[model samples]
Target: MNNNFKMIAKTLFGFEEILAKELRNLGASNVVEGVRNVSFDGDTGFMYKANLCLRTAIKILKPIHSFYVRDEKDLYRKIYDMDWSAYLTADTTFAIDTTVNSENFTHSLYVSQKSKDAIVDKFRDTVGRRPDVDIKFPDVRLNIHIQKNQCNVALDTSGRSLHHRGYRTATNIAPINEVLAAGLLLLSGWDGQCDFLDPMCGSGTFLTEAAMIACKIPANINRKEFAFEKWDDFDEDLFDKIVESSLNKTREFRYKIGGYDKAPSAVRKAQDNISNANLSEYITVERENFFETEKYTEGQLHMVFNPPYGERLNIEMETFYSNIGDTLKQKYPGTDAWLITSNLEALKFVGLRPSRKIKVFNSHLESRLVKYVMYAGSKKAKYNKTIKE
Candidate 1:
């Protein structure tokens, strides 16, 4: 029997292509990239694997139905007409999350309320009871996306966003999201081939993610639970087999991954989080000012970090950024350094031309991930050659 079905993996802006590539590598069929999303076809076991392994996905949604509606009345009628018992029981708890892009449905909250009432009324009319709504920890979460006049209803397979990777229990201020960190690392072309570093590693998000990628470990291996586990049709045996198989595929990582932070507190937190992820064997954290330190490793070095991006550029920030360029150029050689920051004005002070710049978002802030390549030979010789040219 063919159990294949369509599923959508939601992701942050500028990650659709990455997500699509991940899906294809995982054996997804008919992978298509959409704006901030990737749609593909897979089975139940594949769904489990996607939630467990996809590093760039925020949520994996299994679309059940789609329809066209004229108004709230039509929406309620269509929703109430569907067989809700297939997914929900009289005792089960569910929640509706609605997104509105249609002019007819202006308010999302009101749409959710009306849709909830429709489902509740359908159950009460036939089953003599209705499931209660649990907003925080719903057993079965549903997504309603209305674009212009079409509505798409999908079951939320991975709940609370896959960014909640369940590894970092302690975090510093302005910690990077796990998915964002992973995406940035991929964009920077870090494939666990050589040494990796996060110079200003706040809470060690980059360190943890880099180690996981290097070892080919599943992204959500440490997560406690996924929303699909709560579904009535969830197969424990299949999920267990998938988990074991994914773990068996992890490759050995021989390269070293390191992190450095000036603050003692940040170092401790990073060490704690790395230990929680069981990656202490492959990663190390230390307290050191990035500007005063030289390259600790030999050969090609791959560096990615999220530096402090103050709201507005000041003299202090300019000097801080300038020091970043000076340290990279003078102390580090044969290194590919990448950093993401929202402070575009401060980036000018870095005094180095970026080889590549990609537009991304760190939460709501529009940011840029820029890369600089430092040659291994004498700086003066390179400068002289350029001046002569």
Candidate 2:
């Protein structure tokens, strides 16, 4: 029996490469990359591991079927023919999410409606009952993809976006996303060899993610639940073993991880969230404007943050960015500073050239993750050629 199957891990834009790397590191074979997604071969246990450990994945889906359909009717026929009993019972509720790029399908709702109709119609004919649809919390999540005439149906293994991480309870203005924070850390070549800082740490998202990476803690160790747990095939004992194994691999981190924010409320939120993540022992939060703070550590420091983007670059935002560059150039030496912002105009005000600029999206906003390296005893920063578009 071929227990190994193909799984697709969905990520935000610009994370495909890192997600691919993570999958490969997790012992996934036949790894392949697609737009905003990474596909690989893994067993059921590996699937469980991925849901528990992967930091950059927003969702992990197991593709159950793919077929060619010329019209909506063909879609209904194909779905109606699948053995739904193998995956769901008549009492199991489900929700369908459809993504379409076909000329014939202009309304995604219609596509979802048609698919739901087929699934429920099949159950009614076979079992004399139909499962209810619960959009908020479904027992199973159905995914539909249509590119031209091809359709791929998949089972969403991750219920909510993995960013839920079940940790962050506080948020400041423009706090960065968890998956994005982890992806940004990875993009900045962070490997936990040095101290880390998020000077403008709004809600301490970067701080918590950094600690998890530093200690090799599973990203979702704090997450409440996964969609896979709701599936009929869920194995409680296996999941417990996986959790225990991941926790056993956690290493002690000696490096300093600190966060700072100008606002008192922000500092409190950061502290609360850090405690929620159970990283209070390894991380610290303070209320200090970064402009007034100097390097507290004598060793090399790894800094990552999301400074305010000035609402797309008003004068105040430009000044904020300039102060950031000034503080890094004048006060902080032996630091590798990285940040992400959609405000390109304010970015130029940072003054220091970035060694790397990556194209990524923060929700719908197009953004870039830029890195500036400030050398010890040198006022200027080292950087790669500018990649701004």
Candidate 3:
């Protein structure tokens, strides 16, 4: 029997391409890209692997049903007609998450309530008992998405966002999201070819993520649990084999990854988290002001960081940004520096033209990922003239 089925991996804004590429690399078939999501065909073991290995995916959903509905009554009738027993038992708890973008369903909460009622009513009518709803820790999590009049119901294979990699127990002030950090590193072309640095490293998110990417480590190898583990068809032995296979694929990374933060507390927290991820051997955290630091390595460097967007920092934005540009232009040569920030006005103060600027979102804030290329020697002079204009 062919056990293959279609699945969708949801990702952050501007990460569909990378997520699709990741799925393809993971041996997925029929990979197709969507807005903020990628769809592909995989078996049950592949589903487990995707949950454990995909770095850019926020959630992996296995869509079960899709239909057009005119109103709530139509939705309830359709849901009630389906066989919920395949996914849930009378004793198994479940939760529903609904996202509605249609005139018929204005409130998402109401949609979730109706869907829950339908599922429970179906169970009670057929099996004489209904499963209790456990919102926090459900055996199965369902996703409902309504676009206009079309509704798609899916099983959320990932319980929480995959960003909860179970490695970060401590967070400093304004720590970047793990998924976003990994996506930014991938976007910056960081492939472990050179030394890496996050000058303003907060909580060492970039450092840990960069290390994992460089070493080809499974992204969620540190995750404590996935929703699919609670499924009735979950095969523990198959999952174990998949994990072992992925681990065997891990390659050695020769380049060094380092992080620098002026705050001692941040440095300590970063070190602790890196240890938690078992990556201390590949990464180092130090307490040093980025403005006072210079590039010590003679080889090429790849840097990606997110500086304070001035919401949490009290420093002058223009001077801070200008110093960043000055440090790169004068102190750092043969480096590619990339940073994401929501403060567009402050970015102007950097005084260097970004070689590439990609629009992305850090949660709700509209942000830009800007790249600066600092060439060596004669090329440095030409690059200086290019930025001067």
| Best candidate (score: TM-score) | 3
Global lDDT of each candidate: 0.94, 0.90, 0.94
Worst ten in a row by lDDT for model 1: 310-319
Off by over 4 Å in 3: 378-389
Residues 1-389, candidate 2: write the lDDT tens digits. Answer: 87899999989988999999999888999999999899999998899999999999998999999999988899999999998888889889999988899898878899999999999999999999999999989999988888888999999998898989999988876778899999999989888899999998889999999999999999999999999999988998999999999999999998889999888999999999999999999998989989999999999999999887765324487678899999999998999999999888878889999998889888888989998988886442233223332
Q: For candidate 3, lDDT tens digit of each residue in 81-125?
A: 988888999999999998889988999999999999999999999
Query: For model 1, how does the per-residue alpha-carbon lDDT over 287-353 read when each residue is reduced to its tens digit?
Result: 9999999998878899999988986323389889999999999999989999999999989999999
- Residue 168's lDDT within candidate 2 is 94
User: In candidate 2, where is summed lDDT lowest over 10 consecutive residues?
Assistant: 380-389
Q: Which candidate do you rate higher for TM-score, 1 or 2?
A: 1
Give all candidate RMSDs, comma-separated.
2.6, 4.0, 2.7
- Candidate 2 lDDT at 376 equals 82
lDDT-better candidate, 1 vs 3: 1
Cα RMSD (Å) between model 1 and the true structure?
Answer: 2.6
The TM-scores of all predictions, comma-separated, are 0.96, 0.95, 0.97
